[model samples]
Target chain A: MNTAALHKNESTKPAPATVNQYTFTPRVDIRETENGYNLEVEMPGVDKDGIDVNLEDGVLTILGRVQPDNQDGFEKAYAEYEVGNYERQFQISEIIDEEQIEASVKNGILTLELPKHAAAKPKRIEVKVG
Target chain B: MYSLERHLFNQLSGLNSLINGLPGGTTFAAPEGRSRRDEFPRLNIWKNDNAVVLTAEVPGVDPADIDLNITSDKIGISGELPSRNRAEGEAYQRLERSSGKFQRQVDLPFRIDTEKVSAECRNGVLKVRLQRAEADKPRKIAVKAA
Candidate 1:
């Protein structure tokens, strides 16, 4: 990290707001399985009620909100981390069984299981010999 | 004697504040191309009269995998985030979330009482509280009616 650049930037911006509100892209891991696909999104500090997942028009959208830390009369003397919201979207193809998708949130991680359509599943063909 | 030493330290800190007052002087040094916000498990620090609090966002990491160590002048946090993709005949299509070992150490301006420190992890956020050392705590001297 370049300490020199930071020192230079500090003078340019005004003091940040007492309660910072911003949006950040959540990190996601998408894997393809024989049965379907699994998506894992890392969204720390977000409770189940704070997250909203929606799929519309072949698009999957995820929104997450993080509540500020509860401190009893404690002022923010120093800060390096900012509490922000999370949003991400993905386009779903026809092979995905959107109607059968399942989602769950645990330990700030969101997992979505998207099963494949019956027609999309691979089937082995058997050949008969005379 | 203690007051005199504290006065000298105050002067030095005042000078540092003056220098840091310069434009862009206060920003935390970040990687040349990366912003400080880009770091995994970003930290937030707050200090009150009695204690200092530190919090970090570390999702998807098992609590058992986290390791934290605290001393009078510094605190260290380290942990490993296991890969979540485990399925037979599976392959990753897109992976942006980090996996593996991560560690961060922060230095405190004043000593802390290790015995009074406490940590809690919930909903992927780790909160640590460090009580100020006896000598570093502020106290009011009662005035006698003379």
Candidate 2:
């Protein structure tokens, strides 16, 4: 997408552009186990329907969106922070088993499990007498 | 690691700004790197005429783990980001998220009604709402034509 043209079309300042969508990068922690690798991503305020995870061409992408929570009957006098969409991408190596990947989200954190392929697993061959 | 590189970059940028302050014949301009959100548990506090609202972004924290306290003029928030249990042979490749105890206290200018305060945790975000005390609310007076 040509985001520069979109930015130019909405060059007006002080007023937030309706098409302006910020991409927040969530913090990630990756761990490798004997069977596979685990990925933990922090994405707060995202509902179950607001998250999308896709894998294509050895690339895994995580996208999330959240609605701004505003209390009822309270007029905002000032705002010091903003909540926006989240996006992150990672490359899956050949050793990973693409067919057995799993993911779950809880308390704003997304955990992914990528198991390793059988061919990639280490093996020890026994010697036989000839 | 990315964190170490960003830390050194920030330190160099700080020194560069300090160097610019000295009387110099030449000023060096370094290209700025992409800004990173290294600070965990960012907070936002705002107030209206009737109440004050405070929100914090704290992902990976459970609702039962959070401890919140609110007085007439002060609010305190404390919580811990639990670390995930690993298997026997698990090894970390990249670790950036913070895991530990965090606490923050904010002082409000106007007194709030302790009985009316409310707090909720959803989607890893904490929102605290405090209503202004009856005597602390602004009063509107009408002037009659004399």
Candidate 3:
């Protein structure tokens, strides 16, 4: 499949206004289908209410906020990963139908379906016998 | 064996604090011989006077697929992450999310009351609450007048 229609933006810029905490780039998986592209983002600990998806100027942005765990008197015993907000961006080309983009979140995974424009879909050419 | 695990956990917490205090929010490298990949599902542990809470991020995994084991001083988590089904003409553009089997074991500082442990998975995060064994908790000693 030709993947020129969508590409991930590698460099990440800090969000304008955020609290004193780290912002992580969530891992993602992208798949190309005959209809469009499917995007799966991993944002553990983030609920549906805490996610924000926006598309502007041909760029799609995803942000996920995680609530801090309540540790009033508990001491840190062991740690490996840090808890923080998640952010990532992608560049969308004109081949995708911007208006038809769909998103859903479940089990901390966000799935985005980017349907291609009708004109961009590959059409089967039938051969005629004389 | 328990003491050694406790010592290791203390060192890890110390390193975590050091990373949190660094300037410009610099992230620290993983400890020697233990790359991040080896630790399939990363865990964070918190302990109070009588209880310990452990959390891990295991996205895209079904709760039923998660298997947990609890001993007096250790907890084990193992699970299978089912792969997404693909139809004909579907191909991957960028694949980063991991799938398949994963297993991780965490050692605790105190003996746990295995019967009292409870765990729940919410939004891809698994949280396990463990209570210290009744006999292991420190008890107040009242001095009698001599």
Best by DockQ: 3
Model 1 C-alpha lDDT per residue in residues A29-123, reported as the tens digit of each score? 66777778788877788888888888787777777777667777677765665566666666666677878999888878888998989987879
**Residue-by-residue lDDT tens digits, candidate 2, A10-58:** 1112223335554555567777777777888777888778888887877
| Listed models, DockQ each | 0.25, 0.24, 0.28
Residue A81 error, candidate 2, Å: 3.5
Stretches > 4 Å off in candidate 1: A1-20, A127-130, B1-34, B84-88, B142-146
Worst 10 residues of 2 chain B by lDDT: B17-26
Model 2, B86-128: lDDT tens per residue? 6776665556678889887768768999999888888888888
Q: Per-residue alpha-carbon lDDT of model 1 for B62-114, expressed as tens digits?
A: 87788998999898899998856466666665556777889988887568999
DockQ of 1: 0.25
The CAPRI classification for model 1 reads as acceptable
Fnat scores for every prediction: 0.58, 0.47, 0.57
Q: Give the backbone clash total of model 1.
A: 10
Q: After superposition, how far is residue B18 of candidate 3 from its true place, in Å?
A: 42
Per-residue alpha-carbon lDDT of candidate 3 for residues B92-113, written as tens digits (9 for 90 to 100): 5555677789988879989999
> What C-alpha RMSD does candidate 2 show over the true interface residues after superposing them?
13.6
Error of 3 at A81 (Å): 0.9
